[model samples]
Structure formats: structure tokens, C-alpha cells
Target: MTDPMILSGTSSNLDSLRSQLIAGSEKVQLQIIPQLAELGNQGLEVIQEFLWQRREQTPTPVDGKIYQLLYSCGVPEIKDFLQVNFPQGVVPLKSEQGIDYIPLVELLAISDFQAADRLTIQKMCELAGEEALKRKWLYFTEVENFPVTDLQTMNQLWFVYSEGKFGFSVQREIWLGLGKSFESLWTKINWKKGNTWTRYPNEFTWDLTAPRGHLPLSNQLRGVRVIASLFSHPAWDNKK
Candidate 1:
């Protein structure tokens, strides 16, 4: 049954929500829990895609089970799952497809964007850069199994390694400008998690549908370069 206060006005207190999920009728477990888990899985998939498109290095093999869980849970629930499992660290796994990307679409639907300008598409690649993309795939054991920082720089490094359009190691020199860190982008952009609202500047949030969230545009231009890089690296390409 739905929370009475939820209908009345309490919104949702995660602790209470958890209690209700566990204490509710056993039948609820048979039905509702699965749906909730699906939502969580969906959210994970969204983050996964974000990582892939923005990444500049080799694409890692996708895990099947994680994808399944995300396909079911959606975003908020997935966020909750991450909070429960990792608590302080980030969960960087992909699960499903459409569920996570939808939020970005919803954000864009509210406004009008042109297909030709390519403004939205370019903006997204800028967000992922290269260093951030690299760090996402890097199996870092330090920092308690979490990325310490320099996400943007790591992604840029990936771009250089991949020969992607933006990975200008010496051309644009944006990486040189970041000094030594890329996670600073988090600080540069100013994002935050709120109860129900995400204010821009102070915070920014979007789903997979938005131009900024989409990665194919950038990937299409650079994927070939990355693939070539892979072939050149005999060790990686020849690994058995």
C-alpha cells in the first residue's frame, strides 16, 4: 500500500520508505520490490552510458548481471541502492539503456533545441572530456576503491590515448590548463543533490535524453581514432 503520508504530504523519507518496503505485506515483496529494484538498475545504466560516451580510452567489457539489475530499478531507486551499498563511494557500473537516458530527454522536452546547431551535442562531449572517462574505467584500488579526483583530466588523457577529436595533448592545451586535476570540474560546474529540486549553477542534473547527456555524436567522430589506437597497442589488441 502507498504511504498515507506520501499521499497526505510527507513526500518520502528514505528511512521510512525502507521500513515500509521491508515491513509491508510479504506479498509486497513478491510484486513491488522487483519494480523498485528495476528502477535502481535503470539509473545505473544511465551513468554507465554517460561514462562510455564521455570516455576517451578503450571501452571495457560490459557486465551482464549489473545491467539486468539496473534495467529494473530505474534512477532514484538505483541511487538509493548505491547509497546503501557504497555509502561514500561512487558505483560506476552500467546496467540498462532507456531508463537512465529518459531524464535527460525530459529535461530537453521542456525546452526547444535544434538538430542542426549541434550545440547540445558539443556541450555533452565537453562534459565528459577525456580524463573523466579514463578514470571511470580505471580500476583504482586506492582512495578506498573510489576515484580521488581529476575525473575530467583522466577523461582527457583517455581522449589523447584514443586520438578522439577533443584529446588535443598539445593543440588546445585545455588539459594543461586544468593544472593537475579534473574532478575539479565538479567544482567548476557546481552540481548538488537536493530533496526534489536541482537548481542550476548551484547544481545541475539531467537524464540521458538531453543533448548534453547524449554521447554518440562525439563518439562517432572519435570512435575510429580510439579503435585505431586499440589496434596499434599490440599488447591490448593481442591479449588472450
Candidate 2:
């Protein structure tokens, strides 16, 4: 059953809610997006209604917020709805590992980088298996837990989506260029400014225009230990 507080909106109420969502501040939008997720199918219906109504209009921040909510809602049906509606916008790529991924460009097109990031990691976890738990803890001690092919696949998706501006491969290149100096790599990736490591979500850039390697994925925000695990992973040595 749909949560009453979530989708209690009549046509009139939804119209008012939509207007408020479009005009709301970032904090307001964040607070509301999660509530919309709680509505399940009803929440999706509201977003789909808005998307179709604005089909002829240029995408806006509100659209991004809506898409973010959709991704966070984690509904396979909602993702399918997006795939069907924006077929051309969502490009599919096959990794050398024989894994396939849908680039989050369709989501990014509406300007929702956070959703894209979340979806990217979600897709990676879906493909990689038990390694996800290891990834969550930034624990790559067991080489088998972190497959190079999966890492490559994740990196490829980010590279394709951001037009080569962000990805593990991009970070690898910078790391190699700096002679594998972790300190230099950190500074270059904006993970560190001078001697201080930058904070997550806030200090990190949530947009495509961010510098190369700024979108550190695989939940590396826990601390330097996570980042170290990622950098030291055997995946980089896989020529494939």
C-alpha cells in the first residue's frame, strides 16, 4: 500500500507540490525527494506526469531532482520507464569483461549528477557480486574480491558518461603520471588540498564539469584507507 503521507496528493495537490518542488531550495528538494520515494508507484506516477507534461520544454533543475528521486527510489520499473522514454539518451556500453552498463547520461542530461553517481555504483555492485561488501568497507585485501574486469567496467562507464573527465582509468593515468605518488595523486584528484584531505559529498564536485578523477566512486569516502585500497587494487595491472 502507498504511504498516505507520501502520495496523498490529488490532482490539485500534486500541482501545488510540483510547483513547490520546482521552486524549492536545495535543502527543501533533498528533504522532499526521499519522501517522494516513499510513495512507490504513486511517486513514479507523479514524476512521469511531470516529464510528459514538460516534454516540449528544456530540461530543468526540477527534472534533475525528479530523476534523482527516481534513482533513489530504486525501482526496476521506474528505471525501465526511463529507458523506454529516453531510449536515445541512454547509451548502453559493453565492458571488456562482457558486462553491459547503461551510461547514466539520461539522468545526467537532466543535471542530476548525484543520482548518476548513485546509479553508477548501484550498477557496479549489481555486476560485481560479493565484492560489493568488500568495496563498502574499502577492503580489497583479498585480490579475488575485487575483480579487475569489474573495476574496468565501472571506470569505463564513468569515462563514457563524463566524456573522459572522470573515472578510475583517468585517476590511474594521473597517478602514473605523477610516478605513483599517492600524495600528489590525492592533491591532483582534489581529494587533498595541500596537507588536508577534502570532505565527502560537500567538498566533492557533484557535476560533470569537475576535474578529472574528482568523482571518486565505490564509496571511497570512508577515509584514506579506502582510497588506498582502490589505488592499490590489482585491477590496474589488467591490460584488458
TM-score for each predicted model, relative to the true structure: 0.20, 0.50
lDDT of 1: 0.31
After superposition, the stretches of candidate 2 with alpha carbons farther than 4 Å from their true spots are 1-111, 123-135, 142-144, 218-229, 232-240
TM-score: model 1 vs. ground truth: 0.20
Q: Tell me how far the alpha carbon of residue 171 in candidate 2 is from the true structure, in angstroms, after superposition.
A: 0.4
What C-alpha lDDT values do all the predictions have? Answer: 0.31, 0.60
Q: How many clashes show up in model 2?
A: 0
Of candidate 2, the 10-residue stretch with the lowest lDDT total is 136-145
lDDT of 1 at 162: 21
Which numbered prediction scores highest in TM-score against the true structure?
2
